[model samples]
Target: MIARRPEGADMEAKLFGSRLSPFVEKVARALQLKGIAFTLVPPKSPADFKRWNAQTRKMPVVEIDGRRVFDSTLILRRLDQLVPEPPLLDRDAGIAARQRFLEDWSDESLYWYAMALRWSDANAEATTTQVLGSIPAPAALRPVLRVVLRRQLRNQALAQGLARLPLETVVDELGRRFDELLVWLGDRPYFFADRPSVADLALFGQLNVLQSGPTPQAERLVAERPRLADYFLRVDAATAERRAEPGRGAARGVDFGTTARGA
Candidate 1:
């Protein structure tokens, strides 16, 4: 709540990830929350991404101080070290442990449900069309790329065991998770306190994907539960301004008059 200038403005971080990825969003939100300046750069093509990260072949990579770091969790850990003023983890060991546990569950388990919903036959065409439309692929090749990407994601979901379940089952599981979060959060602004934490960022990323992504299944499920819906909005509103100018550090007491919620 205090006004202070962010340090190392000259060393602006560079992030490698697509807009649609929740994992990428997780890192982006953390950077915003920490008031770090960073640029989000998406790959021009699959081969371009392969050249950047040949190992994991994943995104949300952060390049800082001439060093590149990959993985959302690891990127967050590094950010905490780089910008330690507003710490992401709590000082209390037990609270920190719980935050990490929830983050892991949200990232690994809850994520699959969103994937399953997006890639399922019910949502595939619409989701693929919407997502691929933003990619810088040729108009003629978009349809083919969409089919290939959708099929690959569907295969991943199937292998992960979520896509094998009935649609109702997936929805029910998602609902249960939402209910659990509502109960855990109670009336608090964040998962732990009035301010957001790493756990909040992790869950918010997935919730954003579910509620605002191409498929409306998760959003529809949230509609039946106002608390969950409001929580999503809270995170969305908090990050709205930062989403607009991700490369700029948020100034203390900065007023973003017209924020783009769910952008």
Candidate 2:
């Protein structure tokens, strides 16, 4: 449940998650776009999985004004209600509908494709290594964590149905999704609007993962489309700190003076 906001008061937000998660990336970019300053906290140990977010036991959980928000989609929706400027959705009904659809597609469908690629036989080892490298854990724990983490992720993909397909089939189908996006984007600077919407942020998160190591094939596939590449740069620039506009009021709601730090 979301905490009630003090009317017209400044608030602060604490986002507990690793940047490796596209969902986390999407929320981080959304906060940046809204000019909400937040710390990008990486889980210090395996236990943080349940502690940080007991509901889903997932990263990307956010805390503000005694409110804890789980799930990226809900966070974005709550953000739009709290901070109205540079809205995440267009004012036009038709435009907003399309933007919402694209955002959902990015999170639900595109995410699984990337996950399948990550846990595929070819990239699985590299992906495991990267996951271990990103974790802030004790040196002694790395060995055990590697085996456990790999199994958990691979199992997730396997159950999701995409990972069960042949590697070549997954790659080809993913490329086709990119083609569909190009058709949807057409010549627009942003999806359904001149400014970056939740859709753009969502797409950016998935694309960023594709380009960032562990999936060279996915990276190359993204690079194959120059327009899509430019979209990446544009989205990155728009939500970056330099482009972030100071919120009209504030997000200094959370008092992190005594929050735990594993590092």
Candidate 2, residues 1-263: lDDT per residue as tens digits? Answer: 97433231344588888777888888877887777767667888768979988888988898765788999999999888887766899999999999999999999989999999999999999999877877768899898999999999999999989999999999999999998898988899899789999899899888877776788888888789998888888888887642222444443322232111110
lDDT string for model 1 (97-211, tens) is: 8788888988898889998898888988877775775478887887688778788878989999998999888988888888888888988888867767788888888887786
Which residue pairs clash within candidate 1? none
**Candidate 1, number of clashes:** 0
Model 2 RMSD vs true structure: 6.7
Per-prediction TM-score, please? 0.88, 0.88
Worst 10 residues of 1 by lDDT: 251-260
TM-score of 2: 0.88
How far residue 235's Cα lies from its native spot in candidate 1, in Å, is: 2.2
Quote the positional error of residue 178 for candidate 1 in Å.
0.6
State the C-alpha lDDT per candidate. 0.75, 0.80
RMSD of 1: 4.0
Residue 133, model 2: Cα distance from true site in angstroms:
1.0
Per-residue lDDT for 49 in model 1?
Answer: 62
